[model samples]
Target: MKLSEIKEILATAEGVNFKLENGISVPAHFHVTEVGIITRDFIDCGGTVRHEKVANLQLWDADDHEHRLKAGKLLHIISLSEKVLGMEDLEIEVEYQAETIGKYDLGFDGENFLLLTKKTACLAMDNCGIPAEKQKVEMVNLASASTCTPGGGCC
Candidate 1:
């Protein structure tokens, strides 16, 4: 999901709810502590230079359970961020701490916003020295001494 997408969603929703991939929900008392743009620049193992940019939202579970973030209020916050920070319509990356500080790709599953797990992959599979995984082979196809074919077998 992108900033523009969430803005559009917030425009229509009655409340803002975030659901994890495990079916747990971010508490209604959660606060969106931070919203900003993140830019990453790095070199891949394949020697390719790359850059990525995303709008980041950091959700912090707070002690206050009285305030539930309504759709309108969330939209208002986003609007303020846009006006003050000049954020663009970049994809959203959410930071939430469970057992660890996990970063996730943001998405929506119709009724609620979903936190999709992100993974790091080798971008240069072909350039890497790692061998490809071997395919499973039938054991019966092996020429064992016990099963040597015909008279040609010295066994």
Candidate 2:
């Protein structure tokens, strides 16, 4: 989700909640420890130059179970980051602890914000040497369906 999109959602949301794609909820006591822009600039394997930027929000699961990050409070944090860091309406990437620190793409499913797993893809597939995946074709027996006979004109 874009920065603007979350801002709008937070405007009316009663409370802030987050869940993994698997439906496990992030601790309600979780804290948003950091909010800022992350940028990547590099050349792909195809030698094409590229750049990317996203708003990063790091969630920390603190032991302080008494604390809850309210929707308005989170919104304020985002706004402050925008004001100070000149952050644009970039897509949000969330960092949370999952065995190790894992990054996720942010999404909302009506009530709880969802953490979508990020996947790597070859941006330069056409330029890379990797072979295209072959299409799967199911084999069918034709002997039983064939109308042709040794001496028949149907052949």
Candidate 1 residue-wise lDDT, 1-155, digit = tens: 88889989899997889989999999988999898888999998989999998888999999998978888888888888888989888889999989999999998988899999999888888888777789987667555646566786655
Q: What does candidate 2's lDDT look like per residue over 15-98, in tens digits? A: 999999999999999999999999999999999999999999999999999999999999999999999999999999999999
The weakest ten consecutive residues by lDDT in model 1 span 141-150
Flag clash pairs in model 1: none
Per TM-score, the best of the predicted structures is: 2
Instruction: Show where candidate 1 strays beyond 4 Å.
Output: 131-155
- In model 2, what are the clashing residue pairs, if there are any? none
What ranges in model 2 sit over 4 Å off? 137-155
What value of lDDT does candidate 2 attain over all alpha carbons?
0.95
TM-score per model over all chains = 0.82, 0.90
TM-score of 2: 0.90
